[model samples]
Target chain A: MGLPKKGPTLLKKKKMEDDEEEIADLSPEVSDSEPESEPELESESELEDEDLKLAEPSKNAIYNTDGIIDKLGDISFPDNVGWIHRLSVDIDQEQEVDVNDDLARELAFYNQALEGTRKAFEKLQAMGLPFLRPSDYYAEMVKTDSHMEKVKGRLLAEKRRIEEAEERKKTREAKKLAKEVQAQKAKERAKQKKEGIESVKKWRKQRQQSGFAKDDDGGKEMDFSFEDGKAFERSGKKRPGVMPGDRSGGKMRQGGGKGKSQKKREFRNSKFGFGGRKGLKKQSTAEATNDFRDFKKGNVSGNKKRKR
Target chain B: MGKKRKHSETVASAPAKKDAPERPQRTILGWKDKNNTNNNEAQVTESTVGFKNKEKDNKVESKESKGATLNELVELKSCSSCLFFECRKQKDLYLWMAKCPNGPSVKFLVNAVHTMEELKLTGNHLQGSRPILTFSSNFDKNAHWKLLKEMITQIFGVPKEHRKSKPYHDHVFVFSIVDDHIWFRNYQISVPHNESIKIARGGLENSTLIEVGPRFCLNPIKIFGGSFGGPTLYENPFYISPNQIRAIEKKKKAGKYAKKVKAKTRRKVHELSNPLEPDEFADMWKE
Candidate 1:
């Protein structure tokens, strides 16, 4: 056992000297470029985070091609070793992947694995080997039962979280749709009211042309209530007992007080104290000040500038 | 019953031994600091969990005063290949893979380690089933990459018909080189199967892969021509030591206040050299 080991070590020692000489020849060429490379690496240091690499390959780095090939020859298994024994498959990567991009890098790795496995499975199938475990085959697993349980629980939680997010998104969309529908219904109602008014106007014109009734006819007067299209609007004239800002349509005045004295008091209150702010009534509004019909021209100091 | 079980066990193992290729025994030895027991132990155990039958782990103390060096100890054990994990500074885990009794060994700085105990990776397979190794084509692009690939294949691949290995192949090992680092991932191949030994029809199309845990990326630092100590064959010119990186970061931070002070003085000097002239209407608004 010792003798076999000694023989290889002796041969390797002899090869090392020749490899060193080749490195020596390469060292001078490497040294000339070494100073130029250091500054370049310094500039790249800030660009890289956890895993730092030089901007470019250093020219002086040792590469013993023959020695490495010899070592490979020495260490690799003999040619008779079958593919089944190795079970290694090499897959081609189509493009260069940027290391900083986590998603693309991981995708490349995943694709490599997937493609390799496909090729490997085909080879296994051709050889008639047992690739898949039977359904009933029970054995020890790499992870424990307790561990698998945890993994299952985590997967279920992730699925539930995603489902909840989807539900929230769906409800938000539904609310938006409902609001749009409500707005559409209100617009339809407005259109219907406009159409009803237009049709009534048309009918009234037709009736007048056909000589349905005279203007003084009491039975036809009820149909004339909305003839002007101002049937729902309050009249502009002020009533004797009603306040200016009464929202109750003067019903309060009609409902209150039955005696003559109470009616007088109510009328007095309506004129002076019942409703409306006195301060605003005393101030001159824009319309009131602009009304020249209320001014007496003779009483005005017309020649004050000339007199001074 | 015990005697009958033992006889059957031997009978089951006998044919497997005959069918397996002649391979030298592989050993896993690690010397870890006392403070790093938990992480290193979990790493070693999880690594052995895949090929537990073929691998025997020995916990050597960090003290190296013993008569035999690592290579000598491995040679004495008659192991052809050895994986030695050396933990330094209670944090950095350096993995040394050496072919014993001769030359050619690789030292890698292991980073981004996640053990099998993590719950996120849900895949599981038979404990001792042989795993199919798959390598990215870029591994053959360089001489060093090629050598490392062979080393990884030999060390990680379970010998066919290993006594402790199960007959079925239910998992795959992915070794892909990205950014000059070897990334390792183990995935369980779950194919819908029938009662027969073969997969169901269209099972391959429907098959999916789930990741098992114990993921690590290896950055090769040096390749020695000898087992443990030898003339260096290849050196990565782009490789920067972690210590140097840390020191550079510290220097950058230390320059912050000094840089501010220097800038302030320079600005003051610039103002004095280019003093402004008084305006003619400076007192025009004064009474």
Candidate 2:
């Protein structure tokens, strides 16, 4: 019955062997010499590098035409094609990857596609079907691939240039408009001066006709004895005429004869009452004249006598 | 230290202990008697019969002195009767509240009222009292004079022709209605050429002195005879008639009167006329 006092030790040995087998299956490649390096550790490090590469698609190999086609399918175009075209036009023509050639090909293809799409859209519209989705249209027109980066850069620069040119044009227009306004004002001032000179000449003529010397100082006193004698001869009484030291008329002419003329017109109109009604002007003028005569004679006795 | 602390405590409590009064007080007997007498007098004065009798007598005396019967007095209401009457009453006094169309609201105490002629006759009566018709508060004395002149023109219905007089001394006028008697006074405001009695005498002679007081108050039957205790109407002094304006313009033209020049240097001769354009003259006349 005691046939095997070794049964207990054998059982313990078998359990240990099973545990070794399970460990080998779980981590088969791990060697005792590198016990700290697990399979999970190796794969995790490899995944980190992959993640880094995936982070920036434009900077990595995935931004290429093949990568873009693999990720987003065909029809990936750059949105800045116009700028790309302009840059190509400026660059050396001998270059193999001529941006202008690419742009022309792209533009022709886009035009054709746009025409076909528009026709299809019209047909769909007639059938009452939704035609183009804005997102899809932009996706087709914009290239997200790294191969189209130069085209996008060119487009952005051209946009800025166009805006700057527009601003310069607006500035030039403003300056031109301001110059025109200044010239107009200068012309008006010259006209006003001419008118003033003409009025002064007419005033001088009038003064000369009234028996005053043309070259005499307007403010100077003149010897009226001679003129008084002639006036007295004409009508036993002193005649009313332009007197020396009278600068009011001259000032009016220099400033603007229009004011005086306007005043005279207003006075005449008021006297005759001709503005609205008929015959009123004549009647009023006559009455005013009579009243004026009476006032002169009355003043000689009324106010002057009292003062004496 | 213990002794000092004890002393401080005593000092703090001393006032309270000292406030105990010697005895309680009672009202004096004279006080009661004085109060009783005052009450009796008040009661006696409060009797309706006695009060009515005294009030009637006072009213009768006031009416006779004012030359107004009780019924006539009642009929002569306050300025509330006039369409232009705009005033407020405080207690027994009626203040002249000016609702000026061209000025800020002004409240003035009704100082006095004088007839136009009376104001012109009594020159010294308004000396102590500020001139009632003066616009000098808002404007200058010259402006006041112009306003007074306008008022006179409007009241007399006279044309602006008489404005040519250079020495317009007797132009300032005011009117007052006090009791039964209406007194006429004339005041002459003149800018003296020289401080001489002869000049003063001449100014007085040439000045207009109208006596408009006695004529109205003397005859009670007349509308203005009885004292009408209300606002007085004044003629606008600045108002000028068309004929007068025309006359002024004619004189201005014929005389060739130069405008008053504002120069530091004095001119040898002075022209006494206004020099305005024909149109300007017309404009002034039209106004």
Candidate 3:
């Protein structure tokens, strides 16, 4: 009856042991310095302080001991612990203003909130009232479209222009290169001629031997010098070919018998027998000179008679 | 549930789009021949923007003069068809095309010939026909613009010795990129030379020359570098071919059918409610 219950006491001891481990884990300095005893000849009682300063093994041994030493370890938070450890649970607060207190004002908080809310709602309504009409939208779209087209057109024009410029530069560079090549060739030719080298001579001879100078009909020989390429030359004059009257000189069928003059000749021959051309021009001075003319007249009359 | 919600949203959006008017599109524009040779001779501002505005104003006035009808004689207005310079595609996505009004088309023989190319390029051909130089953008780089200017100078720039009191003597070209398309314009520098007042380079003295060109624009789709006619390199999808122009014309014609649509006429009568009068009060006493 004089001592506490066994379970609660054991529980308190276990809790103390746990707390000891926890405290040691949290801060080893607190537990480790306890044993050092470097205080000013220590202020607290030596017995309790010595118990705290003991090493883990010694402390466990003391815990196993059955007496006042075992009871030396006290729990930090016991189940039946009183609030005596804390100074106070709550502050001594005083009311600053009464709940029923009222003050005279033009508008209350609720009324002011409602008025502000109504004003905001009215503003929103006013803002929302002016909606987009179909016509306005269409006009905007058209305007935007026109602007974009202008931009696109401008861009396209610019791109084309740039590309064209680059091409022109390339052509210019090519021309410069060609001029250099030509100048170098001329220089080399002049040097070889001075040295009496046969290469240029041989090349010229070879070109002559290819029947270029005398035979001007060879189309390839016209550009043999490559000198004309330096400047633009007008295309050769394209003279019109001889007319039909001029082509009648050839005796044999006039080059493809399907010509108009040939066709007329055949028609006259069929009508006036063998001397068709002579008969038309000579005007038939002697009317009955040939039996063919009479036969032709008879043939025409006979055919007409048969049809009638 | 998610699928159903998405399907419903799509359906709702489809109807809304159908109800809204369609956007305009861009189409081929006919090259307008400016005959205001006198006004073009007037001294223009040094800035390009001002020059362009002056040119546009002239075109607008010309359009207004021609498009006026009996009913529309009160005020001059620019029709949608006549406003060809404005971009239609960027805003409403409607494509319109006008056939080139010129009859004789100048066709270029696009063959690869080193000698011919050199002759055409190097030879200072002073023939009156305005030369058209087309190049593909696939090979275009930073040097392209400078090259174009050089070519224009080589082809059309008048010599310093030949400078007279004429309005225009030296012509140059400026090339720039707009979107993926390319545009080029020809401009001539004029020097007013008076015999009485002599200056450097003939009688050319205190006078400014305006830029003038019968502008021509063409879109190139491909480029070739071979000696006789080579192969193509990069191809972009932004090319709108001449065939597309024809197709657009056909579709526009089909869509522009004139139906004799009879609009419903309505007539409202006040038979449902009688009109009140002072005589009714007098009649009420008798009743």
Candidate 4:
């Protein structure tokens, strides 16, 4: 105080003190950094009790956690044999907590069913109903969406294949019905065609019988007749080219083509009673239909010949 | 016609069951063992032990399946005594009763038919002091603890509230094996204040434990090799009934009394013949 304190001002002295403090704080940070980096140099033998204790509260939970996390899942339950055994196995297997609630619930139900079934079987044994055995739950399970669904899937696939085959068979039956309908239609069409052809032959024969013999020759364009005398004899009859008696004999009255030796066609020899010339030429067993044309049909007022 | 057929079937089945054993041999039980405990040699054949040991080996050979695992069989075989065995097959409603030759006069009938709902197989947990069935190495190795408990509860169910009026009417049976004999005990698991244990309500240790027994001894009538039902291997002849024991005791008492009366009358006659002769020398009844 007698020397510097008396001469120096108070504010200047305070400033000088603050500068010294700042330098003191800054110098050690730089100097001690190297030693601090060598953390391994903190020898165990030299370790003090103060260093051992947790000195930093900020580092307690966030930076240096002592694993309070597992306690979050803690569920307190009585230590019974069943639960203890279950937990022991679970712990041994080290399974993670299941998030799928449905699976866990189903498994619980399965365990219960299994337990009850086993108990019932045991009871039956005790009751001396020894022949009885527990039914196979696994077999039943395979038919459902259980662990054995793979078997069910294969069985379903086989069932589907059988169903598809049955469907194909149904379609084939429908096709067969359609083919039968087509065959019936063809039979009706052939019958109609035969009736039309018969009418044309009858019209030609009528023209010859109605004293239009020369015109009949023009219609056929050929004369294979050998019995010129019979043709002249037929000239007086109302039906000139046909005789009443010959109608029942030959299916057709062979007015022309006499002695030409045309092969005889027997209608009875045909399988379907058709396909022979003799079949179409049968004399009217029952009269032809009312739609028959008159003998004068298509014979112009006076017969006119076709241009050569 | 159906009734007649059913009756005929029953009659047919009864004889079939009776004839089913390897041989017509009944089980015999004895309180005392005939074999010397320290024979320290090869086993004494069952015949020497007074068992109808015929076809034992043959029956063992005849069993189709290999039989239960040795561990499972051990517990069953070690049950040396059984008070009775009643069988009620699945088809039959009524049970067939076969009381053990040496069994308690009183018994609780164990009926089996129950529904899934009545079984209450779920939501059950170990509570209070449950009956513990202690079996020897036989049960230890082969025992599945959970399965065993479920089976026990089903076989020995606790009576309902109304039926609890009589204590002995229902019981939980604990089966244990000691020295190759199955020691069966019946206990009622209830609060200690309910009487029986006689612990004075005093000792803290004794009051908490709820076990009570070694009450009944069921000498093994027969030890079949299989669980549920199996082929009989041995038939012992020593099983004595309680009535027989009582009758034998009465006969011995009557014989002793008759002898005493005859001795008294003979002594009176002997005294007239030779008054100086000692009582030990008195044999006038012989004359």
Measured against the true two-chain complex, the DockQ scores of the candidates, in the order shown, are 0.29, 0.00, 0.00, 0.01
The candidate scoring highest on DockQ is 1
- Runs of candidate 1 with Cα error greater than 4 angstroms are A1-50, A202-308, B1-41, B48-50, B54-59, B63-68, B72-77, B193-203
List each model's interface RMSD.
11.6, 58.7, 47.1, 34.4
Q: Write the per-residue lDDT of candidate 1 for residues B172-191, one digit (tens) a residue.
A: 88888876788787777775
Give the TM-score (vs. native) of candidate 1.
0.70
Worst 10 residues of 2 chain A by lDDT: A1-10
Per-candidate TM-scores read 0.70, 0.16, 0.19, 0.20
lDDT of each structure?
Answer: 0.67, 0.27, 0.28, 0.29
Q: Report how large a share of the reference interface contacts model 1 reproduces.
A: 0.58
Deviating ranges (above 4 Å) for candidate 2: A1-112, A118-152, A213-308, B1-287
The C-alpha stretches of model 4 lying farther than 4 A from their native spots are A1-308, B1-132, B136-173, B178-181, B186-207, B212-215, B224-231, B236-238, B272-287
Q: Is candidate 1 or candidate 3 better by DockQ?
A: 1
Q: Write the per-residue lDDT of candidate 1 for residues A20-76, one digit (tens) a residue.
A: 333334345554565675665433332332345554565788888788888988889
How many Å off is the CA of B175 in candidate 2? 99
Q: What's the lDDT for residue A152 in model 1?
A: 83
Top lDDT hit: 1
Model 4 lDDT per residue over A1-308, tens place: 00001111111223333333333343444334535654543331122110011111112122111111111111111233232111111001122212123244223322332233233324433544321111221211101234224434554676799899999999999999999999999997677567555655767677668767667456663332322333224334465555566754443666345544433343343544555577566755545645466555666756466522
Ranking by TM-score: 1, 4, 3, 2
By TM-score, the better pick of 1 and 4 is 1
Residue A79's lDDT within candidate 1 is: 77
lDDT of 3 by residue, A107-158 (tens): 1211222222233223323544211121212221111344445545765776
